[model samples]
Target: MAFGTGNQIRTAGRFIRSVFLGPQLAAFLPAVMLGAYWFGGEGVLLVAAVILPALIAFAGLASRGLDLRSPRDSVTGLPGRDHLVRHLDITARATGGNDSQARVGLVIEIDNFRGLQGMYGESGAEAILRQTSERIAGVMRRDDLIASLGNGRFGIAMEKTPRVDLETMIRLSTRLQEAIAAPFSIDGARILVTACVGFALPGRVPDQTGDAYLAAAESALAEAQRSGPASIRAFTRAMRPRVSVPDALTKEVVRALEDGQIRPWFQPQISTDTGALTGFEALARWEHPEKGRIAPGAFLPAIARAGLFERLGEVILFNALTAIREWDRAGLEVPTVAVNFSPDELRNPELFDKLRWELDRFDLAPERLTIEVLEDVVAKSDDDVVTRNIAALSKLGCPIDLDDFGTGHASIANIRRFNVNRIKIDRSFVTRVDTDRDQQNMVAAILTMAERLGLATLGEGVESHGEHAMLSQLGCSHVQGYSIAKPMPFEETGAWIIENQRRICDHPRLPRQAG
Candidate 1:
């Protein structure tokens, strides 16, 4: 009974400290002063003013590392970014700038969170954030500080411990991803989400400041997101993401998209056995005036945040058709142009009409433009409009090429339902297929499945001649990657096409391996 009473007293003390010393105290301070003036005159009001602030400051000083001045995130009930950074600074200072005593800083951001918010409402998005935070906290130690960094991102500062290292952080990152990626249900909708993780190890950090550590982790997270969904990246000396201010970056993205600075750069896809030009995939690239060439990774998030995905799609589709038409006029026999459509764009009700109009405008066959869709959309999307749009396009003679095939765990039924003509194998399975027996087996299995399903297979990311040869011998119908050709602007494609034809005519195709 005595222990229970002591515990209750401590809890009451914590409540008082949190309320009176937290940022919420600002809300009630004016009222408290007003009441004091009404009841006890000017002297009491002045006394209350000084005493209240001093008391709050004293309460804050009593709780070291808590950072009472730091704000809180209403969505996840975690400390705000300021609090985590403040803790980081305090730790750095206390440890006397010793890397041996420093801790790990992690940032986990849900991939494509804007898409979720666009599909569902803000309330539903908040629910996901809350659940994600809960999962993160459940796996963390009590000493670990978790903060909501806004925009579907969370930050964690782990307590200093010798047990934590690179391998440990990697495992923890994987565990956190697993916890967050488990199916979420909100308002009768089942949502599947994945997160990219970035962490700063003390030993690898060049600078000792709190901002430096946090920025490094954020940079790594940005890099991870570029690799694909659920990817992880650790901080390196060369990684820096988004040096500009938020408002500045947003403005630049808006102008870049509107002023034709952002457009498609085409990459050629070829027949592996014959080295013939089969098609070209239209990829988005941003050409900044002063920055030279900006990677899609650096600006895509800004584009999504600005709600201009559909507009970007319009630009790509237009550019792709223009390229094809230009090639036609130049007598270049580029068979087809492949354009990818995001799930949000695919869900547009007028997508079918828009595609048909674009085809009519270009005076090209529907088969001349291939529609590429991510496998995740096929596996996870339940929207009837997306389904209808894809079906209508397939029926209209636009070949449906499924992008990043093996990553989404898409079933055969989903493939058949969407009428996918070709499945482009993800680079994860194709990275080193020539030397890795396991990769060879995996490619073989996929090829066998594709053959049985009557779906053409294309091995993506063929980087070396050996990988190219292995893919051809595996009976992969087509291949696309840096080995064949990097993405180029329309003007450069003519020269590349001519050069590729000359080279292939002089070289012999690798023969298939007999079973």
Candidate 2:
């Protein structure tokens, strides 16, 4: 029979009780006469025969009781592997979907489940599994499906969801957060367990069956697991392809780095107070022979994977320093030029020595180059090692600026730990400064903190007059945004500077560009 509902069980229990206890008492009374008849006389035999039907009814009632066994594991009392598969099969047959709007899957694997087993023993792991299962079961709806996909990995499938309905998906994620956040009790001790979840929406329907949506979810889940516990990542188009860059293209990129095809485009950084060009933040570009010019984001990661970042950093630095020397010769009076340094470049023990050697090679003053380190790399790194390297680089007379300051989780700690020369507010904040109260407050707080620490501040991504006016009012000393100038090639920057100098000489305040 179908398991039916809880109300059915309760009604059944009551009916069984009535059969045994209501008019059923008369049936048992005759059974007493039958027992007496077996010992007494033939007259009692008639009474015993009449009681037989009542005895049968009472026996049926005795069998009705609740099954109280825990259906799943103790640590995560999720159902056993077979039970999970059954759940998946039922759901897949009934409601699974093929499109992004209609399908979603979750693959959650407890990070290092066996490590906990080693620490607490097999029995301890069992207890944890039971508790974990109870929590997970409590969080899920009756109709939703979950399956133990083996080795501490569980799969969840949500049918009929769209990318735009991600808020609903996030609500499901909260259940996982709650389940993992609550500490599991194992052997009289509370052990905190953390897990990472990877999720995907089915792109197509199964031709073969056996929960194809579950498999896609598992793939996304594995990526999240590799990234580490507590990290969640969704599958994207980039993760779908396994294609490698052509060998010729790879070689061309490497060749470009070696042949000085790489150059820095200096976007002028303006002084909010003086409204004149203060410096430039150097951005790297490759004038590929075929592609013409490739943005850094398009190919940098691939190049870094091929172990070319250190060489690439050196090339960009060489070009930027060369440009700085030329700018000085042209009497630009620029104070600094910020160049981005990759973590791969910074982590190199000999990076400082190599930078010094390059500075000497081009006769560039160390004070003119401000190395901009990404916040994420600095935050994740061995701070002591990075701090020492930054100090050594500082002693060489070049300052260090913390780039993309508010972008990472550990920004505040990074600012305090490193002897940074400047903090540039990330463009995301500056782009909407006029309308976003939170962004305005964040920018204000960063400026206030930098001032107290006595470090210079630069606001990046100032695209409008309102943004510029706001930053100026808040005493942001250095600013870079399209309102001033877009990132241009070095030659263009030079031309714009001459024009700006002419305009300033004519009028004290630079006029706003025509809308």
Q: Candidate 1, which segments miss by more than 4 Å at Cα?
A: 1-248
Residue-by-residue lDDT tens digits, candidate 2, 1-515: 34347659977877876766555566467566657777878766776666655665655555432112226544553455455444445545444443544435677777667556655677877776666655666777654556555556677655443452445556677678668757666666646566777765444434213345455555566556535445576665444321224545677777788887777787888777666777888877777665455556446766876789878777778778878788789887777788888877777778888888988987878888888887766677775556777778887888888877765545566666666788888665675576666667767888888888898988876767888877777767888867788678888877898887776655444333231
lDDT of 1: 0.85
* Residues 1-515, model 1: lDDT tens digits: 67669779988988877876865677799899999999999999989988988877776677764555567788887888888887777676555445567777899999767756755679989999999999999999888999999889999998887665778889999999989967788998656677999998876777677787788898888778756567899988777543444645878888888899999999999998778899999999987887566677568878888888999999999999999899999999999999999877998999999999999999999999999999889989899999999999999999999998876778999999999999999776786689777678888999999999999999987768898999999899899987788788888999998888888877787888786
TM-score of each: 0.59, 0.51
What is the TM-score of candidate 2?
0.51
Error of 1 at 238 (Å): 13
For model 2, the stretches where C-alpha displacement exceeds 4 angstroms are 1-248, 411-413, 505-515
lDDT of each: 0.85, 0.67
Q: How many Å off is the CA of 342 in candidate 1? A: 0.7
